[model samples]
Target: METIVFPFSSKFLWAKYLLVFALFISAKALIKLPINGTIPAVIVFGDSIVDAGNNNDLNTVIRCDFLPYGQDFAGGVPTGRFCNGKVPSDLIAEELGIKDIVPAYLDPTLKTQDLLTGVTFASGGTGYDPLTPKLASVISLGEQLNYFKEYIRKLKAIAGEEKTNFILAKSMFLVVAGSDDIANTYFVLRARKLQYDVPAYTDLMVNSAAEFVKELYGLGARKIGVFSTPPIGCVPSQRTLGGGIERECAEDYNVAAILFNKKLSSVLNSFKTSMPDGRFVYIDVYNPLLGLIQNPQKNGFEVVDNGCCGTGNIEVAILCNKLSPSTCTDVSKYIFWDSYHPTEKAYRALVTLILQNIIGDFF
Candidate 1:
């Protein structure tokens, strides 16, 4: 269950919302290295799951830099992360001996020194398909790449060309963003599903994703990690939307993810030979997330189906705010902080799984 990696050459792409980052630049935090990891920096890319604080500046309805969203965060302020606290990228960054949270590339207060490590460039409601981001008015994957290009140009201005080049070559990159494709595109709009069945739609996703990974490799990323499609059918929101089935996972969506992930792994493996200089790793989260759902007690979770905020059935983004009817007293016991995103505790557990099982190969 742990080794279904996509397997790229040097540069890669993970397909999930909480994926890789754009640029690293923030003067507020200290730059420190970890004791056991060899990574020089971490770059993130994707949607809300890994957005950091980029969405705060967006003129879209997908923003969540508001109350109760970050009740468990450092100072109880939402930093645009869809989760209760740090997302997976933040935890993985700390594990890799890098800084804790990656700054948002769109932040206006970023300093020259912040470019030395890494920064995030995710947008809420984004996906491999353009229709998803357009519907939510967030940055698309292609737009994120454009931002990455801009980031490289900015880094060249602060650090010399050679130094900037060295940093990018040595840094580890993570890319994630397929849930939106499922939730917003296929299920809600039926745009993609109308033309293709679940299997065909999954193939389309992998094909588009492969192109994105090739684009990243061409941009100088070497060590890349891609997130395998998680069991979106099991998320509290999906359970609610698919006929009010509490805690019961949606088998149809799970089947789509399984098919999509298999094709994604295969496409990535074949795409690698073309880029002999890049290396790709496909990290499977479906099994791990399912594990948490099925054995909540084993994982110390008292609530695995619903979230801690409000009703926890369908509320998300600004809807899961302080204005909600009522929030749970103990967020730690819940696996989810909201309808779709996992709780900070759950993200931490996933990070431990990656560090212990997948991150070793990144070095």
Candidate 2:
């Protein structure tokens, strides 16, 4: 059995928080990164998009710890990432020149240096809604937070209290979730449809997302970026299930995502205004991804509605395997690697576009 740690009991951790608060109160009303400050690490949370193999060891069917998943990765060995290769977490870290890859916190083979830098706690098939992970038997966001706390302790052991505190304060935090909640739990499963309508369900998601961000702040994360839900209706799997005859984007799903994104952006803006000591940025991945799906050729992608794997209609997770007929010969020409996730090439393109715009937001 494994022991799970909760609560920030260390006096050193509390002292670090108090000291930073005092500095903010006396020196400035808002917190600002020092001119020479550098982001020491890239910490991540949320679902499949940023999950760096966190679900590999978990007792869940929602895993891709086998062939064809990491075919584009180094040595073509599947490291359990839910894509053809590196996901956004790895791309962001690589872009920042921090490291080539961001390891998962739950990975047993994680080295000390990996912890000292950063790691992801994201799991595939998870969402902001509590029930989403339950349906898939995956790690919940709350459990991911617990793992993060455990990670902090290990980081302290490796680098000592002072360096640990600095890394927590200076690190770049990324949150990418909500797609599964809308696509799987609410719409496809019809789990929350009876309890709440579209607007109300979106409210539940935004509230949960806001609460999660606050908890991260309580844990010493200062610069955090939360990605808005993509146009889930346009993803191949959703199109197959909901797009009727023509196999177009599912309008209802896109509407729900738009509702959530609007509220999420507003809430993040409010956080920026209220929590002056923290940098809260809402990253809009919706429009960028939507553009890719609508105009594939502009980005050198031939297929946008379907994924590069198999028939690309509904294959994902266990459904997407090497046993499938075949994968596309040229993954770069397709925006998505599976029914749910983008290809490494597409992720790299999106990360490049995002970094060009938001890199200055953190420091």
Candidate 3:
């Protein structure tokens, strides 16, 4: 009336269980995300193009923390991104599988995980010119670097010294600014127009940009990509301001942008030779964006001359607020979200083109 247990049968069942466990482990490994090739994080610097909300708390009217700005973002919540959704900072991280969004280094709610992934120190209305941020009462490039230093200390605390070094060395670094320098400071505000001519002014901007890259390199960044300014004169606001009654692309603004880009490319080329260990790349957004503007229909964009918000001519930041009555019904059909910033759809296209061109050099 009693049953006897066999040791061989028990051992056979245990062997089957181990086999299944190993298979599961293998399957999981195979499907693991390729978050990055060699880069561990994506550190961003510069102006509104990549600000990612660093200006949200700053005492600057050069901010967009409410209504319509992030209408296309997850939960339709405005996170101070100057776009209808994610900006290039978020798009770049998303493309790299690093993260869905690159948090602002100054975001008070940032977590330790955000630091490990990356964060942007970019502030809207900032530029390579020292006076640019000052004029707007926003964070300057130098102040951004100071914030970066603080980020490094925090990262080291969370990730330890050795891992922090790896991240600083291998992470992708982006610098995107200068539009405000040419369009706002020199042209609209005339803050530096009387002191310096266009050629002299571009030289000043390039010098500042070059110095910034060198400082970043000294801080352990090796793979740095400085984005060329877009055709600033062609943006809706500039066209309205300087394009005369016809609202055409401001030719003079375009000229200054071209000059600055040429100098910037030259400086980056020189860095490649001088800083042999570092990879300094000049990422061109001018031609690609210009092509989009000149041939908007090619990219399914119907409105290249104006933004989706307000009159699409002058409203931006504080001006392009909730009280702006209405926004374009189809933001995807437009190239810009506000008078100055590109729409999320436009940023997606630009980011795709950029990654395709520079991924090889960066990795």
| Model 1 per-residue lDDT at 112 | 57
The better-scoring model by TM-score among 1 and 3 is 3
Please list the C-alpha lDDT of all candidates, in the order they appear: 0.78, 0.87, 0.87
Per-candidate clashes come to 29, 0, 0
Residue 186 error, candidate 3, Å: 0.3
Model 3's TM-score against the true structure: 0.90
- Per-residue accuracy of model 1 over 246-326 as CA lDDT, tens digit each: 457777888888888888888777756876677788888888988888888877898988888899998999788888987
The residue-level lDDT of candidate 3 at 354 comes to 76
Candidate 2 C-alpha lDDT tens digits along 259-335: 99999999998997788889888898999999888777888989888898899999999888998776788888899
Clashing pairs in 2: none
Looking at model 1, report the run of 10 residues with the lowest lDDT sum: 14-23
lDDT of 3 by residue, 1-363 (tens): 122222323657644644553354334331232333455678999999998788998889999999878889999988888999999988887876667899988888887787867899999999999999999999999999999998888777665566678789888899999999999999999999889999999999999999999999999999999999999999999999999999999999999999999999999999989999999989999999999999988889999989899888888999998888667789989999999988988988888887887777764
Which of the predicted structures, 1 or 3, would earn the higher lDDT when compared with the native? 3
TM-score of each: 0.88, 0.90, 0.90
